[model samples]
Target: MSDVAALLSLARAAKARIATAESCTGGMLSAALTDVAGSSDVFDRGFVTYSNAAKQAMLGVSPETLARVGAVSEEVAREMAEGALARSEATLAVAVTGIAGPGGSEFKPEGRVCFGLARRGQPTQVETVEFGALGRAGVRQATVAHALRLLAEALG
Candidate 1:
């Protein structure tokens, strides 16, 4: 089984449901999870909040966090995950934000990603990663893979 398939197995065994909040990956994590058969049993819902305003309006991300961290930081990702968990009835949630781009900025640059995972009754975990200057598709694929791995880890 693929690791994602394994994650579904774990979640099913634990009777847990998961949700996702996505930005740069644009619901890719949710797409991947739902690509598997029987995912509806373990997957709850997904949010695609590509804009800072949508992040605030939909996922309850603070405008202050967006202003301070520029929508692609660990703080926003954490808030997205927590908000997804709170908004959905899922037991676990994952969120991602990044610049999967051929264009962006000097300091943040391309291929910079942030991730967050929240499980009900547990403190949320957040991390930031730089995949350097990969091609846009490559960076997005890597981000989805990494997010799936984090989801599997969280379920365990």
Candidate 2:
């Protein structure tokens, strides 16, 4: 089975609801999770916070955190996950933020994605991965895959 299917199976078994907070990948991660049959049993909601304003307004991502580390940083990703969990009735949340593009800076290159996972009664987990110059679509697909894995890991 696909990663998302496995995650939904595990979540349903555990009676866990999941949410997604997405930035660079837009709602792709959410789309992937919901694509499976009967995902409504485990999927709760999704936040497509592509802009800094949306991130702050929707996910409660701190403006200071964005100004300090930018939207693609680990700090913002963690806050996004935590905020999703807070704003929804979900037991678990995953956040993705990154620059998936043909354009990137020397410091924050393209395909550098930050992920955060928050589970009820558990500490939030944050990670940064470098997929190394993958095109925009490629990076987004990879991010969705990684996000699914993160959610599955958290369910465990």
Candidate 3:
């Protein structure tokens, strides 16, 4: 699951294309996926929705949802994943939103990330990972790693 090449191969074998919707990690998930050679067939596209406006405009994340639970919540992550899957030609999509930061409140701590995985004709799943104060770079790197795992698991 940590191996990007193996994950890509799994997707290709399943004929599953991938799309990503990222917030705190920016486009790091997309970069990780495309880092491997011959990923074009399985990696479809990515949306770096770093802002509330961008999330609404690009991924169709509901303004109401954002206002209700904020961008870092499971609701927003779920919407982002579903939105990405609906907007792309890909069969599978993953979304992430969180506070990978040097600043965070008690409600949402630093290194707290929410992930959503959506596959065609299947129920979308969401989970929260409290990576714990792993500095900014560490949180982001961990996010990309976990995202790769999510993609690999989704292939099954």
Clashes of each: 0, 0, 0
Q: Judged by lDDT against the true structure, how good is candidate 2?
A: 0.93
- TM-scores of the candidates are 0.97, 0.97, 0.97
Model 1, span 19-125: residue lDDT tens:
99999998888999999998999999999999998999999999988898789888999999999999998999999999999977988889999999999999999
- Minimal lDDT window, size 10, model 1: 147-156
Per-residue lDDT tens digits of candidate 2, residues 1-156? 976788889998899999999999989988898889889988999999999999999989999999999988999999999999999999999999999998899999999999999999999999999998889999999999999888887777
Alpha carbon RMSD to native, model 2? 0.8
What does the lDDT read for residue 128 in candidate 2? 100
Query: Regarding TM-score, does 1 or 3 come out ahead?
Result: 3
Candidate 2 weakest lDDT stretch, 10 residues = 147-156
Candidate 1 at 121: error in angstroms? 0.7
Residue-level lDDT tens digits of model 3 in 85-138: 999999999999999998899999999999999989999999999999999999
Q: Candidate 1 — which pairs collide?
A: none
Superposition error at 36 for model 3 (Å): 1.1
